[model samples]
Target chain A: MHPINRRDFLKVASFGGLVFASGLSGCASRAAKSEADEFYFVQLSDTHWGFQGAPNPDAKVTLPKAVAAVNALDPQPDFIVFTGDLTHTTDDPAERRRRLAEFKKIISELKVKDVRLMPGEHDASLDRGEAYKEFFGETHYSFDHKGVHFIALDNVSDPAARIGEEQLAWLKADLAKQAADARIVVLTHRPLFPLFPQWDWATKDGEQAIELLMPHRNVTVFYGHIHQEHHFKTAHIEHHSAKSLIFPLPAPGSQPKRAPIAWDPAQPYRGLGFREVEAEHDEYKLTEYPVVKA
Target chain B: MKRRTLLLGALAAAMGSARAEPEVIRIVARKFVFEPAEITLRVGVPVILELTAPEVAMGFDAPGLKLNTEIPPGKPVRLAFTPDRPGEFEFVCDVFCGSGHEDMGGVVKVLP
Candidate 1:
């Protein structure tokens, strides 16, 4: 084996922490004591239900396969969250609706109970998620679960997924309702901080959203857009991303353009699937399981 | 060095050439995305995408092609297919990473 550089090791460790464990050690142990709030959620991102292409010849079948894998999880997630890319195009309403209808069909095939969703640019591209709202709900909103404050934002509404003053204000009031010590978990289609602005990954007003979240004692954001599991911490808040259910993209800066990653036929279906985020109180652990774990 | 071996090799090459494919589009990957967002190739020819991602672990799924595949971090993936018709087919990342996902796409324009 080659020698692992400290930088790479730190990166690996950081990704391990984000992809698998909550960095704060104390919080991790704390979760063990509070079984009442011990809850888990499944992250399903970038389904792109209507997509068809060269990367895979069986995309139509694999999507449902991923959902089936999620449904087969042992403990069963309290709820399932779909981050974005529900469809492939932004301009075609008929395509969007057709894709969403297929999404609904596969989701209906889900053995799991509750499925929460946020719009990705592909789903909201044409009209800033106007159609998505009619199907899902408000673009951005909040809810509470077992003393945990959970908020979902609509950042992919515009070209840059601008959080805007309205959503920012809502986030502020939403956080104000917390007791200061309450652990907050946020969900959005885009990363809460600037991840890769060049690729339009960062929300234009993500900083404002981060500022709204900064006041909380324990803050973590779950998002999907990049198509892989990556996490970052800014201003004391942690931002974690989920993998897509459709195709995988190259990392930021590594390539000139972000497009569907192609694969060798012999070893196809290697790097895709769902992740399980389990937590209690301020601590959480995420582990991504490729669809075919064997 | 050997006359018999040379003749056999030449004959094999000829047979291969006779059945050679008319078209194939190749794709390359670096860190987190595809290199060519759009590719054009002759009709009825295979589109061979050379997929790659850096050391960071990631997976790949092509919903359109009915392909659910993974790109082992720090390696290469090559996908081949023949698009019988000409149009734009979209591919989205199946892995859960943030930022450039919805933007991750490519097109194959098969011309007559």
Candidate 2:
């Protein structure tokens, strides 16, 4: 198992060159500030809402905890992004709907301007993400915040783990709309580059998407599914994977089986956490906070 | 002599059917598609499908045959079954992958 590495700089940015001034010592109060200087957003992934039992006896509670945490942020994030895996997957369409609906209700408690959602395989795979799209929106899409372009691609919806030709074309066209120096952030459930094929950590055709973004010097990716914080770089693009809310998985290839690590009754939700990124100028700062039993 | 020769021919044919081994099919599932989307086999012949997913988790479901199994990343799952009759069966990736998950499918043709 490779240990987590914290080296180099973790930077966040918005279209307006927003940089979060809050460092490891987070803000204690939401003070009125210079809006032009920086902006921040929260990323909560792998909530696994409908999850029940062994791996997370309190699976239902963690998601609400995350929401409450976000709401309590001294300076509320401009928006919130739930990367994927909103609920546990089941073949029954009815069960899937119930889980999705319940998750929506829970997250509604957050106070944010906008909430961008994408599906992890668990929420999309069975019905080809129909439920997810119906509940959320397009599986792959993009929008601009301030001056940065954020593209959310649906790598989990494809069983083969590709972005598909149609989506790829869309991406090419989308990138063409922006300047070469435009700061771009990609959001998806699976890692865009092949992290570890054997563990579904990599997207099958993510390299093509990366190639399209290769021309752009400022590109960053935030994804979930690995259930742990990992940082990787391909070419000039930087990729970061977030921790899951339900349970954590072992490091890549650490165990013969890649199942979720059993919930530590003592630690409760130690390694399971969420991320907050603040962007200023060209520098992005990311901090991860784990869920603790209330 | 003619009768003995005819009897031996029939025995050889019977032995051939008895000793036939099951055909093996290796299936790999990626994001939106499965490799070798079409599989062909003879009716009444036992076949084994070895399934693997290079990334993520997927499921192969053929409701007609009551078959459903998960394809985990970097793991091999073996399934054994025989085509009962000559016909075409469609199997789809039951696991939710991404936008193309529904399109991830293959056809199995069993010949008489």
Candidate 3:
């Protein structure tokens, strides 16, 4: 919540080190100092509310506990974004709506007033996001906050795991409005690049989306379908995946099948948690925190 | 002249049989895989893919061949298409079936 100062600038610069180590340009430091745009947000993804099984026995309590965890943050987050998969998939239309309503009711308890929501394949693909839209307005949209342009994409709704042509055109038009050097953050459920297509980890038309975002100098993508902490890069655009609230999945192609890792009673909620992304100028400092610290 | 006429009639019958019936390939989809993951076909031959998902509703998406369809549980969905070119293509279960849905895909090889 505080503005970027010398200490924060140095902290960000230290990660890369080259640009600032040679000589801290006055122009760069001045831009970091003057702008009150420094802020951080919480990213909670893949809650899977209706999911019940061996992968996560404590599924009922996970979402609520996550809500309490986010509320306890010291400065709190500027906003909270639920990347996707708010609820598990279901064949029954009525049950699907029920899960969405219940999931919404639970997240409503979060202390953060600004909470953003999107749909994962589990929440949208079955019915083409019809039930999900009944609860959450639009599957894809864009907004701006504190000098950062945030774009929430809906790659899961189409079932084929594509962003669709209509949405792609919308993205192109939206990017045209922003400056070339704008700081943009993309939020979605599945990875835009083919992390592992065999496991449905990659979005079908995600390459086109990445191409659209390529022109922008500073662009960071945050997604959650893999249900683990995974990092990838397509050119300069960095893609970071958030941990799931319900269960953790195996590393991409680590095994023959893409099944959920069985829950370990000794370490309940081991790999389940959210993240805090602190933005300072074009640099982002990511802090990973456990759901309840094991 | 009678012998020549008979030969021409038999040739016409053979061509009709070749073009009238398409080859049927049955593929079973379950959990996170297709029964016959890898399939081979001849270019210009019409084929009908009989798809069925035993447990959940799954999708058959062969983007390379522009063939996409939904296979509901307990019911069979038939998709007919003719292989237009000689090359390898990929088909995947576009629907999210379970934890391993991402890996539910196979390659289609077409012979020239």
Q: What is the C-alpha local distance difference test score of each model?
A: 0.69, 0.78, 0.83
Using DockQ as the yardstick, the better of models 1 and 3 is: 3
For model 3, name the residue pairs that clash. A198-B102, A198-B103, A199-B102, A199-B103, A200-B102
Model 3 residue A236 CA deviation (Å) reads: 1.3
Report the CAPRI category for model 3.
acceptable
Chain A TM-score compared with the true chain A, each model in order: 0.89, 0.88, 0.90
lDDT, candidate 2, A145-173, per-residue tens: 76568999998777556678999999999
| Deviation from native of the Cα of residue A219 in model 1, angstroms | 0.4
List ranges where model 1 is wrong by over 4 Å.
A1-19, A24-33, B1-112
lDDT of 1 by residue, B1-112 (tens): 5999999999999999988864444454433466676666666766566666664433444444554445666677777777666655555444433334445655555577
Ranking of predictions according to DockQ:
3, 2, 1
Per-residue lDDT of candidate 3, residues A1-294 (tens digit): 111222322333221211111111123533665458889898999999988889999999999998998888889899999999999877678998999999989988988889999999988887888988989899999999888899999999887788999999999999999877788899999999888766667888899999999998778889999998776667778788889999999998697567789899998998888888887765776777778853
lDDT for B76 in candidate 3 is 97
Question: How many clashes show up per model?
Answer: 48, 34, 5
How large is the C-alpha RMSD of every model relative to the true structure? 17.0, 11.0, 6.9
TM-score of the first chain of model 3: 0.90
Reference contact recovery of candidate 1: 0.00
Give candidate 3 misplaced runs (Cα > 4 Å): A1-35, B1-24, B28-58, B61-92, B97-112
Ten residues in sequence with the least summed lDDT for candidate 3 chain A = A16-25
